[model samples]
Target chain A: MIQQKIPGKPVTVTINGKKYRANEGEILLSVAIREKIEIPHLCFEASLDPYGACRLCMVEVVRKGKREMATSCTLRAADGLEVLTDTPEIEKHRSILFELYLAEAPKSDVIRDMAAHYGVTRTRFLKRIEQGDPLGNKCVLCGLCVRACSEIMGAGAINFINRGPYTVVNTPYYAPSRDCFGCGACVRVCPTNAIEMEDVGADRVMKSWSDTRVPLSQCECCGRYYAPRELSASVLARLDTPLKEEIARLCPECRGKQLAQNEILAGRGGRATHG
Target chain B: MDERTLDAIIARHDAPAGRLLGILGEIQNQEGYVPRETLELLSEKLGVRLSQLYGLATFYSYFTLRPVGDHVITVCMGTACHVKGAVAILEALEGLLGIKSDVTDDGKLSVTTIDRKFTVEIARCFGACSMAPVLRIDGNLYGYATPEDLPVILGEYGWTP
Candidate 1:
């Protein structure tokens, strides 16, 4: 783990033979990722918990005379821990995983791009490509979408059902989802375009490979759909109290225009009011 | 902390609208690091978004989510310091205390010791090129420090030989 922050006390850890100070308990992959260290991972997000499901961020850790290979995302940047990110052995192990990922989604840009980055031109392993959501989904199931919906958006609209390789993300009971707000929060967080959104009149439907559709709201001002009706209404209702009710009816761009107009007026004249 | 204490802490600030920095400083000063629970408490009490509060907390180097040690050890690794053997001096200190550098990890300025006794930190430069290879131990500046100067200096701070 590398320590970049120079705050109160800095702990030092070695990465690729160079000593770097890092914060205690920070994920090692984040250290490497931030420095453009080229540790391939799909399940890693700074905002979310360090889920080591990707298995791509493995690094050789030499700490206090013990050598072990550990997932960099789960590993803490403790002092005296020496991490070797790119070695022949580490790369060999990583290439196997990358190769497997490619076989899973040969058309997947995620695996293909990363494999290209790591120089994995081809995979000898036979493609046991399992079927996934439409648009050649290529969803590696990093769980970022599932976590984001429940955590960030506070909407437990979509989730993973079943176990093992048969597991797929879906709303409860694989139904059309009456509970879904059409927020498309899951779609926004999806690693792959497996979850897609389309506008149909006043409603915008977020579609997944499971054939589930979530309806959303169309922007009133621009006649463009932005969010689910419930979410939009809630946000507008909140803004109305402290802000102008007219601003609530307008979309973000219009609101920006209104603010910009106010700014220009204020700049041109003193105490300018839109009304 | 209890809600009453948190309420009093909020009361110390002029208002609940924009005293986030002041409130964070006060909380950090009182409790070694800002607790997430405290942040949630502040969010509820102050009506500030949790995300906004987190932005401020992580942006400022002074604010730490983790507890730091009593003594702060700062080494200069700026271009001038590097030419002056700052890396060697830092390595020597690391060898002495067994604290490694994690600069590649958090992009933070410092990393505290595991025992929480010391925080081994680094800075680019103190604007003192002449005094290259400088490091500070508990606010006291040591210029032109060599690998040989470590154990003896650390001994002065009651570091066991």
Candidate 2:
């Protein structure tokens, strides 16, 4: 009998002729990352579901003398699953993809560094640099930022507009969005740091999304503008018991101190009512 | 274009699966183009996000967001058509219409005349390669089209000069 640590049934999968343990139905890319395998992947955030948009983590899954190329990010782990991450065929495919990405995001330092690591110094594909590009020409159109904004933050502020050869992601109608929360989930999840955002005097401006501005809430105690007003209001609304008005207006650091002081006073006094 | 008509259309294809595309197609057929208001109404009725609807509309070339001209001149840009001098025919139309073929920021190639009487657009293929260098004007397909034939063709549409 084996001790089970993870929730699912333990399964062993082979990657590049080496056996590794994985939970059943776990994403092969997640398993590879946990084992310190150098399988490069983008558009895969742990919090969000794997969509396999980037096609970087191509692996050859061998089954009964048949080999099929599959994205490891979307491939589920199973018992006796064998995959080759660095075969000649996979290397060739990855090199072409790297070249395409190089052409796609010509100004991306991350893409340049990663492509260089794979010995792809130049691309044969025509380079496209949009004049006055809002994303600084670093975006690979991986849809990570778009997904993070919509799926995670529920903002739905931006999306991919147009079709093949002319495809680009931006706010609808290339206008400043009214639906954005200014939570910065998109910025945090972007693989290439393509989204440009700034805190410019009492407002958080999403510079890439047509300079959409979200108002910042000022802390009553310390006079520091911390988070977006709408985001903070929505978060505060989700709390089980409503916080005191005074404490709610304070920033996180000031609120923490106030809460601690209240806790001490509550312990010392018999009937100190703390909201 | 009204709420009642939109609601009726939605009701027709409001099945459990694959309703959005069907509803959108019907709207495109009836309205010639999918209006923003219709999309907003659909979003509210179907509980779909506006961004997703916009994405679907833009992804398919069949759906046009802007209102199309009274007469649409669609030139086939397929390999077969290109080999048959489609570029020359297209350039001739541009000169005749006084509208340069401009690619939008999102990469769609379309140009409408100032009068909005004619719109010149490029299609990947109309799937009629046998009749290479095909151009369709308002559902009338002109096969084996040459730059010389454009003036005579526009005459049929009541265009002068």
Candidate 3:
């Protein structure tokens, strides 16, 4: 087994004139938050991987006589670097970043809460049209769910397919599969709650995660929700036997009908069984 | 209240919650960030609480509550950009700016490393996959960016190393 290298000894870095020691590879934002620095962030959730999508943790770092903006969640602490957490300029850009998020997902309560904290009562851009008002629902497309699934769950079940404004996340060919364990992690991490799952039958359901809805179906014999409709069809089509018809006919109601017909053909099944 | 200032503040105060963000954007453009005093004036004029005003300002990413520099540099750290050494580019920028991603320099240059920006956030694939690593200064796209290219890019924006 390849041994993972342990981070170097902790080093002291000054943030907003307050000095703190941080271990190597531990993000500055996490360290600051641990120390109650209150660095604003949206996409850096401890439960999930740090995406740095919200751009709210932007901070000023002075190192080796050079200064630049760095994401606190992604930036590792370096010795002798001076950091400023709440400068006037940082507040201004953070306000703007929040405004952009509002433009992308205006109705989100999470965004509203963050904005309230920062004192932004207005924005300069056009208001985002509400869903069904030509603009549709507010999904900023942070891809948090997509990353969480692949990185943490080890299920490459969902991915972004298509391009530009029309892009959406889905399984390949817009079909559900056994690869999806129905964990619902995608639904949890979605910033906008755009993806929805609805129960269609016993252990069977439909997922409206994107534009195209995928219907998940259960196996009639085993009563197990095996795969989505599109996936089942594609798989059975490749099989030589009449598995597709067998699947359709294996339901309790269909099986009962078949049994009655078979008995009637033998002249031994009649009104008693029918009733 | 001066006629022009009152009108500007009143118009912002009277705007709808959704439209309020846009109005605030205009105010920032005019005054170089949402002034705290202007926020107070708006709160009183619009009959909104200061807390409500702060809520709105902090809710969106585009509205600035404080002053910003003359030029803004936004680096993309989207998935495509990340796989293409966007982190290294951001580190190089940090070295050049003497400040971190969301902080502006004393010289008035605001640098931000955004995962996504504008209406077209880095939420989805940027479709500039061919460009690999990309950065935007004032909404202009730069592809195949490198640490070596930082000076030239900053120089074009009147930023001297």
Candidate 4:
């Protein structure tokens, strides 16, 4: 009897005419990308589950003489699965899809980069007229920011509203959401850089996030600003016990230096006691 | 919707209609649309990601996160329907609602009105191309619907003018 998917085992997959070893059940998009195989994709985040929204990471899979198109992000890597990344058929569809995205946000640098990569000179589809700057990054509605907010940060502040051409990410009831923590996780994970968050010395302002502004934690060591105070406190408060939860108000670099100094002091103390 | 009711609906999944789709279908039936609270409850109960739940919710036209009016009116915007004056029908409905082609204040077409009386939405197709320019009010299909008939049709649902 043939064994199917031994748990906790690695598998070999053939990608772009090359053999590569991958963890069983790993997303094919990540495996392809990790192996240096370029498959132009959007709507994929390392912190979120495989969402088959963008459909740009399409790859032709040949299994036992049957060929089919599958979104690499949603499909898992399996043993003996032959994946062709850059076939003309796949490239053709990617160009058409990118054109649609270009038509939406023509001036977006990320979209332009993809267009340049695919050699898309112009879009065939008509762009929708919306009130905003053409050169500013626009939401392609890939939902990465939404996922990062919900899945990664547990902040379900924003979600998809409307459908079809009018679909967009907005706070609940189209108002400023109470769930946003000012952590900037959504801004950091946004693929198109459509979201912008700024740390203004002592306060953080996220314009796209319903004008969210929160206080920043200053590093005790050097007076440099670090994480958002509310976000840090919220995360620290989520610990199992409520016994005096405290977060060190220090920058990462300062924290690292302090940790090393303490280790050296502890080592010298132990040597003195032992000697 | 209460959390206990949602838990009960989730427990009622069977071979035919007990899966996520079936459970969501049941929720949609009870609430006229999928509520965010219900969605969050289901996500919490099932340990599923919110994005995945939202992806499924947005993928289907029947499932809506926003509240819907007592009566939902959908106009077919398919190619066949579009060519046969569906745009005019949608425009008329928008005029009546003071919104653009079923679009809500948030630019979303599926949102309910302030009073929750009527919700206007655009459908991809009803699969009845023969009856081009079709519209549906509360699941009842109307064929060859014209812009002039908007008031009379809405009047049937106790909507005056």
Best by lDDT: 2
In angstroms, the error of model 3 at A76 is 0.2
On TM-score, the leading prediction is: 2
TM-score per candidate for chain A alone:
0.84, 0.90, 0.65, 0.84
TM-score ranking of the models: 2, 4, 1, 3
Report the lDDT of model 4 for residue B148. 89
Error (Å) of candidate 1 at residue B48 is: 29
Query: How much is the lDDT of residue B153 in candidate 3?
Result: 84
Per-residue lDDT over A61-127 for candidate 3, one digit per residue giving the tens place of the 0 to 100 score = 8777677788898787777668898888888898888788777667666677778789875667666
RMSD of each: 22.2, 3.6, 24.2, 6.6
- Sorted into a CAPRI-style docking class, model 2 comes out as medium
Estimate the TM-score of every prediction: 0.56, 0.89, 0.44, 0.66
The DockQ of predicted model 4 stands at 0.17
| lDDT string, candidate 2, A1-275, tens digits | 11224657989999989999989988899899999999988788888888899999999999998999999988999999999999999999999999999999999999999999999999999997888999988899999888888888888988888877777788876778778999998888888888899999899999998899999999988988899999988887777554736545888899888778878888988444465
Q: Where in model 1 is the C-alpha error above 4 Å?
A: A1-8, A130-132, A135-137, A209-220, A236-240, A244-247, A270-275, B1-161
- DockQ ranking of the models: 2, 4, 3, 1
Q: Tens digit of lDDT per residue, candidate 1, span A1-48?
A: 123354434578889988877777777887787677777777777777
Error of 3 at B71 (Å): 48
State residue B47's C-alpha deviation in candidate 3, in Å: 60
Of candidates 4 and 1, the better by DockQ: 4
